[model samples]
Target: MDFGLPKERTSLKIPPALGEEVQEGRVALTPQGVRELVARGHRVYVERGAGERAGFPDAAYEEAGASLVSREEAFGRGEVVLKVARPTLHELALLRPGATLMGFLHLAVAETGLLEAMAEKGLSAIGYELMGEGPRRPILKAMSEIAGRMAPQIAGRLLEAPLGPGMLLSGLPGIPPADVVVLGAGTLGRAAARAFLGAGASVYLLDKELSALEEASREAPGAITALITQSRLERYVAFADVLVGAVAVPGERAPVLLSRELLARMRRGSVLLDFAIDQGGVAETSRPGIYQELGVTHFCLPNVPALVPRTASHALTATLLPFLLQVEDDPLKVPALRQGAYLLLGQKGGHLE
Candidate 1:
């Protein structure tokens, strides 16, 4: 993954620092990316199912000089394991002793069981989320940005006819721009703002925090408007052409910021993009679901991230590729994610003797 930093920063000795060192099809490492590694003389192993989603086949990894291995073989041979999600118990048990596992480990909310598991593993477990700033994981934030940007595209597809406030996104002369209300100013919110603005819509970004609101006001211009008031939130909600719910509360279920009364008051046919449906959603009516219907409209589609597999895959690759490089550099220093990383090197069975 591209960590948005220049390659060759001798300061940190991380693998992904090399620019374009890892290409998109690098489940086992593409030939191009692998050739670069081989030139440096590094033996690489990749687990099956790792590159499948990225349009990379098993042959590609083999062609790149990476030994095609099962999860067990890969973890056994690999001193460092880089993963998207925290490894399940099965995944974690496969690692060799002294192996370091790097990925997101969101243990802030007293996830002591996982913490205990890591300690028992006797591996130096580092969390990606903790390595960076507070509460936010950069990789997850990047993925959220992609998800938020896609919200409008999905909304547009769903609302092909009569999209809002009696005006079209590509309005004719005298027609106003579509109204888009983004309910959070975090990564997802800002991404949604940019996406909507690109679609020729007037964006109103709402957040309870002054800092977030201020950031939006300054970073996004023209079509983007930022506000810190809850009073007017309903007014905009009722009149919006699209309501994008990206608000989040981290480990806890996201509170319902938009009430049932307000939802009922919303303009008929206006779309609601509940991006946080997985986190209990930001709308009162939202449930943990892929699709939900309320009165005249549907809301709270979880797994919106899965809708664009190719895009999600690339986004993930861009974000985490550097971490893998970091692992390659030291074969240690497992950085846990800000939240929800489960992989660790040790399990109940015992470490490699």
Candidate 2:
């Protein structure tokens, strides 16, 4: 599993930090991951309490051969920095110049200032979302499965009294079940359809690609699949009690499917769960996290899996460990690492563009 890299390239000085203040509940690496890295001769710096929220205590990391250091030391000392979310302004400023930064760096919708700062600092940045070309995004798929499975449960809660019309997702014996319309037929969309169907809701899955629809149908058999068009989208959305926007395009902004006008036509008290918010959202009104507008509940959090931190962290580590092991001083030298990278040595958009 060296991926054909030279012996020296397998070892890296890595720091797994989530910053001084924990913005995300998930940690990039678990204690088990650290132990594996350490056995391979990498120096792992675990920021004090970095994995606490994800249920991995400082003592656990210490026992696994990680040095629990202060936040500043963790960020400043490592040749490569690992994180869950994109770094904040303060966190970005703390990185050592020329250090390699890896995480879910969603650069498409990121601020211009943030991109410029990374360039100025001479950092190499890799995004989890962009990892592996042509539908082989392992990291993105793992997280998307979590978010999609969570959507139905979250929608059920939001559909209760006070927040939404007192309607059950799985209607009573004589009553009709809730109508769930999901946009996109990709990983997240298919998962959502399966979960909602399991919850006893009637699911309608739509995508522009017929092949994707066919695949989703086989995965979630009870779902009613449709080709996305203006007429069909408007029709299904209007009938939806819970509308899920699970649409995504790799390395680009999510396509906006629902306009404000289209959204306004939906029944009052309906719920809109936009899983695509990380890549600019599938609805025009979507903003990060939950909000209320026009009598509809909007849960547009970019990191929905964060709600289940312990589970999310373990899943992330399992998928990310191999990639972390592949990292070398110069990431671009590795083919898989280069595909995932958006910035290399302060320069953006050479291979990435």
Candidate 3:
């Protein structure tokens, strides 16, 4: 598992916030977030080009008192690797076998091959998505926010093409507002609803659960329409100009909320933004695409955060680095579990037993 954005161990803290693409290796932090770590005695390592894509430069890491190294050595030396994407087989192949890995481990429906490999490696995988003990699954929640909030922007753009609605989302004069229908009243769904409503569109929120719909109703107040669905969801699908799919089931494939046959019923240019696309889309037509789909005109965006690396990185980093500092302090917390073989150790040897 890796949200996989990593820094080699170092002992300095950045004094300010770093912007996206600061110059590879240069990550600005709240000087205090770093200073506090130093007070506890920790070292940070930076890979030569890790932050380059995010605009952080190598010099910035040096200035922050971070030693630089090749990606090979950085991961080689680090026990807890922070990353954006889950570690690939090649990445796992490089690990010392019994390593503790953390990030968004979407294991409920993880790729079978990856699961087999992880089990084979004896990995004690702690899913950021699943780590929430009782009521607060924080990491997965953040990822959902990333996908949900961005769904509207993607939908609006796709709907504006000539073959599509061909109109600016907000009208100029006599034209009416864009109509957006949000399915599911969960966190991601609500975020999409709030964003669309704020953007001057007519928003309709539909959910089978009255509790969810009622809670959303309270937030929207008079601004939005809360439709409590007592029957099948068929009628709701027929009326949507833009449909945002935000439903979820932890550790399982996303359930189909809308069928292709049903999707064909929406306005020809109507857009379906399935934020659930990552775990098998809610729509038959939606599936993960190549990175270039950053401009994915039609269908869902599986990796929405990569498109807004600047915001996504900062948000992801904010949550990750603190835990990293703690691990750095108790280096054994990571390597010990790795060495002990009961924790998130990848499935390497029969040692998992």
- What C-alpha lDDT values do all the predictions have? 0.58, 0.81, 0.57
Q: Give per-candidate clash totals.
A: 25, 0, 43
Could you say which candidate leads in lDDT?
A: 2
- Which lDDT tens digits does candidate 1 get at residues 87-203? 455555766655666544433422236656565766545444333345546666866777877876776654554332234664557877677888889988988888888787888
Q: After superposition, how far is residue 181 of candidate 2 from its true place, in Å?
A: 0.2
lDDT of 3 by residue, 1-353 (tens): 21122542222221122222222222323223334444555555556766665556667656665557766655555554544455677766655455555555555545658767766766555555544435555556776777767766766766665435585666557888777778778878877787787777778887767898888887765335555453435666666677777777655578887666766666666667777876787776776541112122345545566555556556655654455455543333553223322234444322224
Candidate 2 similarity to native, TM-score: 0.92
Tens digit of lDDT per residue, candidate 2, span 1-353?
Answer: 11110000011121122112224678878889888888877888878878877798889988988888877777777777877788777787878898878788888888668988898999988888877655598889999999999988889988987778989999989999999999999999999999999999999999999999999989999999999999998899888999999998877899999999899989999999999898999988987757678777887776778777799888988987887777555556766667878898888854347
What's the CA RMSD for each of the models?
Answer: 9.9, 6.6, 7.6
Error of 1 at 350 (Å): 25
- Candidate 1 shows a clash count of 25
TM-score, prediction 3: 0.77
- Residue 25 CA displacement from its true place in model 1, Å: 12
Write down the lDDT that model 1 would get.
0.58
lDDT value for model 3: 0.57
Looking at model 3, report the run of 10 residues with the lowest lDDT sum: 10-19
